[model samples]
Target: MAWDYKVIDGSEEKTDLGFRDEPALNHKRTRILDACKRRDIDDLQALAISRGGFLTDAIRCQAWPILLGVHVDQRGEQDGISDSWTTLKKHRDEGQVKLDVNRSFVYYPNDDTQAQLDEKKSQLSDLITEVLRRQPYLCYFQGYHDICQVFLLVLPPATRAAAVARLSALRIRDFMLPSLNPSVAQLRLIPDILRAADPTLYAHVSRTEPFFALPDTLTMFAHNVRRYSDIARLFDALLAREQAFTLYVFAQIVLRRRDELFLQDEPDMLHFTLSKLPQDLDLDALIVNTAALFERFPPESLRSWRSVSSSSTLKTVRDVSACAAQTLEDGHRFFEKHHRELIWAQRRDKVLRTAWANRALILAVVVGAGAVYFRKAPIWSNLAWSVPDHYF
Candidate 1:
C-alpha cells in the first residue's frame, strides 16, 4: 500500500566524482540487487558504503529492509496490531509525535496537494505511534519524525514499522532518551575524531564545543539536508555502518573545510560556520573520506570511547556485522537494556544533585528506610563532601 510518493521524480542531481557513467551505475545497481538476492549482508554493506548509494529510491525499496534485518515475511506485521495498540496504553510522547508529524514534508514532494500531504502526514503519525506503542519506553525527540519520514518514503507500508523500529532501537536510540545527555555524549565524539584526523584544525576549532554537530547528527542529516535524493543516498551509508560512523562523517565534513574553518579565528565565527553545512556538498567525497577516516581512527582508539559506559547501546550494539544478524527481538532486547541503563544514569544524577543541594541536611543525619539516625562520625563528614562538584 504505497501512497503518492511524489518526491523522487528521477531528476537526481549527479555528483561530479560519483557514478559518472551508465555502466558504472548499472554495475553498482547489479551488485546491490545481487547482494539482496543472496541475502549477503556484508556485500550489501560494502555496496552501500561504496561509490553511489543504493542508486535510487526504487533500489532502496528493495534493499533498505534487508539492511535493517527486516525480512520479507515481516512486512505488514504491524497492520492488524494497530487496533490492539490503540486499546493498550499510549506512549507518553504521542503528543510530540503529532506536533512533529504535522510539520513534516516541508522540503520535498514539491507538487503534491494539501490533501495528499495530509494523507502522508497521517501515515507518518500512525507509523511513529505504532513503534512507540510497541516500545512504550522509547522516549520521543523532536526530530525523530524526520528520520521516520525517510523510511516511510523508501519502504512499502507493510514493512515501514518493522524497518523504523529496528532503526529506532539500533541506530538512533541514543537520541530517544528522556534527557538529551546521551545525544550530547555522541556529539562529544565529533571533536575527538576531528582532533585525531587533523590536530591543527582541531586546535583551531577547539575553543568551541561540538554542539555544532548536534542538529545534523541527531536527525542523521535528514533535518538539514534539503534534497530528497541526497539525504536518501546519505542514509545508505549511515544505515550500513556502526552508529559512530555518523560522527566520523561529520568530522570529515569539518576536516574538509579546514581552510574555511581556519579563517574564522574567533570561536563563535568558526562555530557559526561549522553549524551550517556547505551549500555545495559533494556527498560522494564526504562519504568516501568519512569511510577512510573511520578506518584510520576507529572508535575504540578515540577518547570518547573510554568514557562511554559498558551498558551504553553506543558500546554494546550497532556493530555492522553484528547488526546484520540482529532482528527486531534483538533490537528490543538491546533497547530495554539501554533504557534501563539510561534510567539508572538519570536517577544517579538526580540523587547526586539532591545530595549536593542538601549536603548540610544529609550531613546532619543518616536517613534509612528502617529509621532516621543521627551521624557524628568523621566518615559521615568525609562522605558528605565526597559528592563531586562536577555532578552538581
Candidate 2:
C-alpha cells in the first residue's frame, strides 16, 4: 500500500543565482536520458529525486513522457487520432473550456509580445481539447488548464496529448474523477504530510481550512508559482517521483512560510496568505526540502493516518498501472453499452450549446459589452458545477 523510500544524501552545489552549474546539470541530464533509453525507471526516479530535476526543456521533452509511463505508440492509440477532433466537437465542456482558455494568457511571460502569447494560448486550447476528447470520462476542472499548459510548452505537440492523458489517468487520476470528493481526499493528505515533516507547523495549519492547498494540488503549482520556468523545473521533479510526493512539496511550501502563516490566527487571513505564493521563492531549496521530507516520512507511515476504507492514498507506478487498466476496461464496457445513444445525445447537445453561445456573443457585441462580455459570460456558471447524472 506504500512506497519504499530511498533517501538522497549529500549537499547540492549551486551557482550564485541558485541554479546548479551548466556542467553539473548537463551530467544529470545525460544520466536521465540514458535511463530513459534503457527504460530504467528506478535510475531515472533516483536521479530525479537526488539531482532535484532535469536541467533543461530539451531534457524534459525526452524524459517527461517516459516518467509519465507513456509509450510512443500509445500516443495515437489513446488519443484516437482518427476521430479526436470530431469527438471534441461534441464535448459539453467546450463553452467553459473557451472561458478558461481566454484567461490562460497569464501562462506566458509578461515581456513576450502579444502575438507569441496568442499563439501559445491557441496551442494550449487545442491540446486540452484533444486530451479531453480522448478521455471523455474525465471531468474538466477549472484549474486543469494550468497543468496542461505546462505540457504544451515543454513537450512537442505530437506527444503532448498522450503525455497529459497518461498523467491525468495516473498521478492526477483522483482529481479528474466525477466529483470533488476524491480531490478533497487527496488534499487531506497535506496535513498528514506536514505532521510528519514538522509537527508544530502541522498543528498550526490544521486549525485552518486545508482548502488552502487546493490550488496547488489542482494546478500542480502552476497557479501558485508565477514564473513558467520555475513551474517547469518543479514539475520535472514532481513527474519523476511517485504521485504522492507532491504532498511533501506542498508541505515544504507551508513550512517555508510558517513565519508568516504562524502570525495569522484567523482562518480567512491564513487561507488568503497561503493562496498567494511569494514571487521570490527559492525553488531549488524548496525541492531539496521536499525530497528530504519524503525520505524522513515515506508513504508507508502516512497510510496509518487513513481514517476510512474508501480514503484515497498515495499510489505507486504499479498501482497506477493496475488502475489504468481497470479504467480502460470500464470505458470499453460503457462504450459498448451506450456509445450510440451517448454519441447522438452529445452531438445534439453540442449543436444547441454552440448556437446558444453564438447568439449570446452576438448580443453582447451589439450591446457593446466589450471585454465584459468575455468575462461576464454565462460560462462562469459552470464554475463549481458538475455534469448531470445522465452525462456521467
Say which candidate scores most in TM-score.
Answer: 1
What's model 1's TM-score?
0.83
Task: State each model's CA lDDT, in order.
Answer: 0.79, 0.68
Question: Candidate 2 regions off by >4 Å?
Answer: 1-22, 73-84, 87-89, 303-313, 316-392
Model 1 stretches astray by more than 4 angstroms: 1-20, 74-84, 347-392
Q: What lDDT tens digits, residue by residue, belong to model 1 across residues 1-392?
A: 11112234333344332545667766777888998888777887788877667777777877887777676554446322445556668888898899999999999766677888898999999899988998777889988999999888887777898788888876777787677777888888888887888888888888998899988899999988887777887999998888888888899888889888888988889889999988577887789888999999998889888877554556755466677566656656766776677788789999999999999877666555214332456677688789899888
**Candidate 2 local accuracy as lDDT?**
0.68
Where's the lowest-lDDT run of ten residues in candidate 2?
A: 1-10
Q: For model 2, what is the alpha-carbon lDDT of residue 253? A: 83
- Per-structure clash totals for the candidates: 1, 0
User: What is the TM-score of candidate 2?
Assistant: 0.72
